[model samples]
Target: MSEASLLKTQVVTLRVPNELKSRLEQQAKSQGVSLNNLANYLLTTQLSQLETLSGIEQRLRGRNLNDLKQKIAFLLNKVPHNPDLPEWDRL
Candidate 1:
């Protein structure tokens, strides 16, 4: 956990399938970016997505599912049905 270790970038070699690698290379070429840059973009955003999902799970950890369901039902019932869309009443 030293500062130098944190700042260092190590090369990683992945054994990806040939077809996937070819597709990634083609996409990077079409976008006028280096394959490395494209891979970096994908890896960084995928991690970001996991971070966002973790944040959502953390925020909802203490929520009660039954209470949420009841609240949603109450809110749905309170909404006035449009006369033009009578199907809403059946739903």
Candidate 2:
């Protein structure tokens, strides 16, 4: 199946205050586009930014897990209950 076909579309009903609605319509008209197209364009831009941020977060999370694993391994390999002799720090 095509990528577009795999994605489903849904309609959303939003209630905007009159002033904001008027501004959006005015902005759309000034840009020579339909109100729906303008809204969709704005949403697409914002969603793209969020998607990029999410990908970055996923990458960082993977690195954090690896770091935690390394720390755990280091701790596990330490000597068991070794005495902290005063001379060790007497330099």
Candidate 3:
């Protein structure tokens, strides 16, 4: 055994939907790895991606007004314009 493998690790108790657990088990079996290993790999990879995106977001914050407005406009254009609505739905 390697030194890294011998290092102490904390246990985390996670509650997942039965269907999701079954899918994860199937994936782990197909990859010839234990469920714990697969979950660790997925969590580590996703956290890295989120950290990268967060860095980009922080750097872009309060940097561009026109660009942000254009992006918002582009998104707003994708929504269908409808004035007809029930009184309860009107803001």
Candidate 4:
């Protein structure tokens, strides 16, 4: 990336709850990032998720069980499954 690309970044100001501020500060320090950079990255990622979910929820709010089941199946497929081990017979 060139210097112009880095210089094209926008400045944003946001107020976080006091507890979250301390946690973010610690995370930023440990990751060797400035607080602003950490906040910007997190906010950008979460905001994108929020926008997507908001659209989905708006469409599905009053839908029926079939829709709900399909959503559940989609999420379940994304998760790794672990099978239960057989129980040992006690003496």
Q: lDDT at 50 for candidate 3?
A: 100
TM-score of 4: 0.52
lDDT of each: 0.93, 0.86, 0.93, 0.86
The clash count of every prediction, one per candidate, is 0, 0, 0, 0
Runs in model 4 deviating more than 4 A are 1-7, 17-19, 66-91
Clashing pairs in 4: none
| lDDT (Cα, tens digit) per residue for candidate 1, span 30-91 | 99999998999999999999999999999879999899899999999999877787675577
**What TM-score, to 2 decimals, does candidate 3 have?**
0.63
Instruction: List ranges where model 3 is wrong by over 4 Å.
Output: 1-6, 65-91
Better of 1 and 3 by lDDT: 1
Per-residue CA lDDT of candidate 2, range 2-63, in tens? Answer: 99985767889889999998999999999999998899998999999999999988877747
RMSD of each: 5.9, 14.2, 10.4, 7.4
Which window of 10 residues has the lowest lDDT sum in candidate 1?
A: 82-91
Candidate 1 global lDDT: 0.93
| Candidate 3: tens digits of C-alpha lDDT, residues 1-91 | 8999878789999999999999999999999999999999999999999999999999988878899889989998888767897778754
Judged by whole-model lDDT over C-alpha atoms, candidate 3 comes out at 0.93
lDDT of 2: 0.86
| TM-score for each model | 0.64, 0.55, 0.63, 0.52
Model 2 misplaced stretches (Cα beyond 4 Å): 1-9, 62-91
